[model samples]
Target chain A: MKKYNNIADKLVKSSIANPERIYNYLLYISAAFFSVLIIFPFYFLFVVSITPQHGLAEVRYLPTGFQWENYIDTLEIVPLHQYILNSIIIATITTVFVLIVASLAGYVFGRFKFKGRGVLLVAFLIITYFPGTTYIIPLFRLFTGNISLFGLATPDLYGTPWPVVLPLAGITLPLATFILTVFYSRIPDGLEDAARIEGCTRIGALFRVIVPLSAPAVATVGILTFILVYNEFFFSFLLTDSSYNNWAPLVHGIQMYEVTTVRGSPYHLMAAGSILGLIPVTVLVFLGQKKIVSGLTAGALKE
Target chain B: MGDVILENIVKQYEDVTAVENINLNIKDGEFICLVGPSGCGKSTTLETIAGLTKPTSGEITVADREVTYLPPKDRQIAMVFQNIALFPHMNVHDNISFGLRLRNFDSKEVKKRVENAAEILQIKEILDRMPDELSGGQQQRVAIGRAIVRDPEVFLMDEPLANLDAKLRVHMRTELQRLHKELGTTIIYVTHDQAEAMTMADRIAVLNKGELQQIAPPLKCYNEPANQFVASFIGSPSMNFIEGKIRSGGFESTHINVDINIGNYDDLSIGDPITLGVRPEDVYPKSNSPEIQSQSDPIDAQVDVLEPMGDEIFVYLRLNVGAEDGPTVTETSSADQLLMSVDPDSDVSTKDNIELVIDREKLHLFESGNGNAITHGIGEQTALNQNR
Candidate 1:
């Protein structure tokens, strides 16, 4: 009994001494389980998309028959090519516009102090959570008929891509400005002082020192804006006409076609469409994963 | 190269006057150091000279050109910050070449200067490594190398050695002095450490509350501090202060009931109060030593704490009769902490009562209320009084 107690105590001591190893092992297993849980839905989507239209009814977890026909059928039923073009244009324009305007506003807000700056920042944050419907009527009126301000008329903006793209860019600007501002502020003040001492003008320092050092942060913001623009639906649905119909806008096409009203709906087709739409964005995020992680956590840990 | 001068330089930020009426003449090729405690405005004065900060009023001249309004780069000066400020993304070579590139220096000239500076700093092998890859000392050397490549008329360093460890800081202190000799350039260094200023500068400027207390060679500042502030600040184990009233040919202490003779200054009236200053090194433990006995009866203090450093032991003691109100047992308990440096080999320890004698000539005198030194030259005195 004494020997057994000594052995038990030794085992417990060793386990306690290296608790981190045991904790890490448990973490690895947990990660494996969570990965499977997340990937299962994606696997189901893939299998359903490939399954023949007739075979899908009997299908449970996996595809029964390999029929490329479903893809062709789905493509023919909707204006897929035109919708893809519109999505590319909108996402590209929104991301580019957001990044440019956000970085400019972010630099000013981050590096300078002026009266009402805090109030302006708080106002932006408050508006962030307010419903977009509240602003829609006012925006529509402004675009339809120019409002005069200080003896100048605001430019007429009707039925143009500017109405959709510009509004999306403006909506994204505030938060992007806040994020980039924080990133900019966290850069060591020594760097700017050194640049100024090195004969760099304020603009020169921003370009030569601040910009190069901010590459990772810039990449992070760009990827996030791209994802936000790619996945947006409500604004695209409300603002777009026949000429502006994007792939996200086509999600409404299902409603007009009497698909959403049917009982026990053809969800397999809708799921297939949703899965296809995620491909481009997934590719982009995967390519920029490292930069995104580094940029977001840049200010988190420091010496 | 032209001499630099600050004329009635004043910097005010809202209610705080960071620097006030500082007048200085920095000769060409002179290495000057600004040393002071925190909030003393040594850094503010340096920044104002560098054009990194604009004075609220007054003018600064560098290389004979009035540059108070000029930008830092146009001032033909370079500054090495306390943090070093190396470009982390670039290697040492590129960091050195950046300024030259901005000025559109020839590619060949840029490479030659970069290589030369790297060789001088002995960082030639690590030229390809980014700043983050190097150790603190190496990064510091690289920072200096970057400055060397610019070859500016004046090099300003704001406590560059502060980030280094004690051992490395001492080593680099000598290295910097050697570099200054070889380069023969005017340099302005800022630090709160008197030892750094003493070791590296041809002259030292001590500041307090944005005012220049004194500017002189290290020894001169030490031997002849312009005011009570400089006397106390410029030494380790700081100079000890004793407050008393001037008596006939001596100083009379209310608590101790003892008097110290002041040869000629005894003519100072009996009612006038004054501060008597003495450096720890100038005060000795024995009345028998010829230097100690020359003064009448030496001041007596009881030992409190003895700190033994390798070369010297610091003896902290309290005057048995201390403060003004009474025998001041409580105040004496706190004021009992007087530091005196003795040879480390001495057998003295705590609890031993010791006599402290001041070298009369070395003793400093100041008006009790205003801590200014009583010096002659009424002409210079007018300017001094105006600053006050």
Candidate 2:
């Protein structure tokens, strides 16, 4: 009787089929797996940045000893403070300029009816689809005044900060405009009409009513522009050569440190520079994650 | 001071004529409803009056001033939309006082006006709460409060109660009338519900296919429709139309042959196709009625369906004009089916054979081709006429 009872109990336990529970388990397992995959790099980066002077040559799962001097050494070797200030200036100006141009363009694209609206929108879409590097050669020639457009020589912008700021703003324009356009389109026309009837001109209504409501999209665009200009190295490298290192951004400065100081990859210093460089933007994204999420899912769901 | 007049108002979209030749005069403190089916240009007319849409060519005079080209803000018109349009991010107080603050009104006056509006809308305590926290009905009140604080000369509402539940809608209807009485401002309401138009508007303007069908008091439009479309549209279950021809100094058809007293309709002649219409209540089941037997020829019909409304029953009967037996009715189209409104206490069922009769004095005649009402009654009928 005891043996029969044990066998029946096993059969009854195995008979349970709950697809929902199974799906939940599968979801959790996959999510945990991917989470580790994504987080492992940052953990490794921190570990390498903290490895002691002699620990770089050791093969281990983690640093044997911690070194607090690497961060100080990185700042001392490279003019990290000056590079950070330069990056902040360029990213700030680019973010502001992109916001102004893209928001206005987005408003016009969203609400206005003019000839060639479709064609112009399609052109903007095509520009967004291509990688910015595709225009690198032409942009280099044009900025350096080496090319003529319609038989007119372009202005010389090779060594100044203008080339970096201008192209960064232009490259980021399409994304900002796309975000703001979708945000603007989701607003009901009735709201504008209500504002118009409530004693506001079109532009006044746009600033008073529409702008305040688009805080999430604006934050998203601003953050994206900041991150783009801050991490951008190619334009900064091409625009300002070694003689103009004063205008060199943070990433370009770090790249110079890697190339000039060491013959090959310096894992400890590279990890240390990357960790230090990502601090500001990581803080920003963490702070405004809610806004970014809302902006991305603006028209799809209610909340 | 809020009388509005539109002269030769024509609005043309790229390939569609939204409205054309719309001329209307809405007097001060009068409630006028522009009622029609969707895409009938009633909303276009209302929007034109509100200065939300520019007319291709017209002169819009509001409060004795031409505002044809003026923007909505300068026109002294405030509109309430169907969606309520309460700004989601702002609290009720801010949503209501935003316009005042924008205009640089003194804080004291803005506060006073907002308070007064809140009291009127009965949402004073919830002023600090965001819009999403409020119920749909409360949100609508906030929207109305926003419009009222502007104190515009003309109030335009485009189906303001359309989004509410039926019970709430009925309640809001009375509430709107009360508000109109208290404020006494010119209101132009647009809706597709004839019942709503009839209940609220002092004058109802009916439109069809972008053209005005009739503009008169609700009861006047109901009693004396200028065209067959208005007659059919103004009533529920619609006024029944029995197509026949003028013959032998009366009317004749395969399913129904009745002697209609048109009271000197001289233009009508024999062999002219005419459509006779009667309200459902005016059609009685003569042979089955417990009341005195009708002194008229019995109309042989078979009851197709019975719709039992609470107070009254709508009996749909198919007519028989020529058959081999007592119910000898000819093979006629389904349009020959007659609708009769009877008291709910009557004994009637689906598929029952019965004889019906139409009230002669309540008859209406229209030309078949153009749908022009040749003879129609004027003034209101009894309130308990069972018009459904």
Candidate 3:
């Protein structure tokens, strides 16, 4: 035991003397480990996506043979293009709606001093804490026109794109508003004052100075909202019918593969559909990776 | 044409009064510096004049036009802030011409004016560089350039050089003085640094605790401070204040006594509390008393500390006259210490017992109750009494 203690002390001292080199080696090893951990599932999904359905039992680390027709089969089995189009439209509309409303709400809550501002901000925060399932029944009733507001009948938007777009935008707004509020508030007040002194109105300063400086946060909110609405399953599945024309999103379309297959579950086709669905989100994240990182980390440290 | 006037300006926020009943009448092309310690309402006073902050009740006029309620842009004024609030997204040219472009000036005219401002500031070469790429001094110059291109009647600056390095601050002081000379605009500068005000301002308006103390030339403020606050605040080492009371014979305090004649002023009565203020330079060793024409009697002191600068040495002297028996001397109280500035070459060291005398011609007396000036140059008052 005494001899072991001496060796451990020598090892500790050596590492401490050249800590940076050891630290770098440990950093790279752990980073590479995490990279593999994150990438392995996606890699497996892609390998399974192109493997033939009959070869699944024999499949190990690699696919036995390429079955490129699985992608074609996945598209033909369901109206995947129509679902993709529907998802695109819904995500775009939801993202735009959330951005516009959140930016305004964020600017007001962040900059202006008014009565009940704290209460209102806390109320928005509370809305974010409640899960979507908790409010789905009431939202379904409201959209189907069963729940009237102020003695006026709510519009029947059950099977249309509005049902999915509006609620998703509403669901995403609080978090987006939170990000924007924190980002906008961190900007020096002097910039707005300078703008006003230079002949800009309050709103002009918002667009010209505040909004331009907040591009990273805005892109962050946009990408998150787009990906969320694109892949939303429960709400879109419940709100809209299974008809592709009725604006069922890609997630709903992917779920269709489980039931509509004639034989035992065609897992390859499902994998192909899921892989194809990830393209848009993948491209968006790649494009806005820097912005999202900055947006999340901004205001965490003081200038 | 750009005379600025602020009448009865008062600003109160909830419980605190930022500035109260402030009035200033600035002449055209005058460089006036509003200077004070932090939270002294100097910046608040300047903001009210610039129309950035509305005074609770006051009237302001710029260029002979009443602009009390007008917005800052409509008041024909441009302000430079302490943080150098240049839009970080814009390059130097765009930042300087932001106001011009907002007003929808012809593109050609805006270009010409930006170029002219750049030339005036001598930053013409870096017009295309971003704000973060510029050094601190360059960023401040860009801020000033932004103000100058507006061609407003009054230019308000709020501690624009407070962020620069000490050497750069000194350099910008001369540059700002030159700018004031060339522009001839009614520039109202605000800073907490008295040295900056003393060097650049034609008139320095000293404020303390939301009240304007005095507005006078730099030398007048130094030589004849309007009150004790003005006296202590305007000078670098600060004027030494010795609290005492007026007796029938003269002024009496714990450490020393001075014979001041009360017959010269009707307001002063026997037993009235007074404060004696004398600058560090007015204090001298007893050996130089023969060269001084009107000097006070020697006061015994022991040197506490010595700080020798290139030109002079600041000798902190602990008055030994009353410290052993006086009730005011405590471990923390600085009231018993006097700061004296002697010639740098003078052989003064710590802990040396010495006798010092103040120049009577530069002595200032203030009423302790209201901190108002009672008299300057007590020697002249005594001389007048003797002549009579």
TM-score of every prediction relative to native: 0.81, 0.85, 0.85
Q: Compare candidates 1 and 3 on lDDT and give the better one.
A: 3
Q: What is the TM-score of chain B in candidate 1?
A: 0.90
TM-score of the first chain alone, every candidate: 0.74, 0.83, 0.88
Question: Regarding DockQ, does 2 or 3 come out ahead?
Answer: 2
DockQ for model 2?
A: 0.28
Write model 3 residue lDDT over A1-303, tens digit each, in one string. Answer: 999999999989989999998899999999999999999998888988999989877777899889999999999999787888899889999999999899899999889888998898889878878888999899999999998789998999988998888878888999999899988887778888888888887778888888778888889899989999998888888999988988899988887888898787788888899999888788878888765433332221113
Residue-level lDDT tens digits of model 1 in A189-290: 677778888879867777677656776777777887777766666666665554433234444443332343345555455555666667777787787775
TM-score of chain B of each: 0.90, 0.92, 0.95
Question: Model 1 off-target regions past 4 Å?
Answer: A1-41, A52-60, A69-86, A107-117, A144-159, A203-217, A237-240, A244-277, A293-303, B104-106, B254-268, B285-288, B291-310, B316-356, B375-388
Of the pair 1 and 2, which is ahead by lDDT?
2
What residue pairs clash in candidate 2, if any at all?
B320-B329, B321-B328, B321-B329, B321-B330, B322-B328, B322-B329, B322-B330, B323-B328, B323-B329
Give model 1's docking category: acceptable
Alpha carbon deviation, residue A136, candidate 3 (Å): 2.1
- At residue B26, give the lDDT of candidate 3: 96
Higher-lDDT candidate among 2 and 3? 3
Q: Cα deviation of B158 in candidate 3 (Å)?
A: 1.8
Chain B of candidate 3 versus the native chain B: what TM-score? 0.95
DockQ of each: 0.28, 0.28, 0.27
lDDT of 2: 0.81
Worst 10 residues of 1 chain A by lDDT: A294-303
Instruction: List per-prediction Cα lDDT, in the order shown.
Output: 0.75, 0.81, 0.87
Clashes per candidate, residues 3 or more apart or on different chains = 2, 9, 0
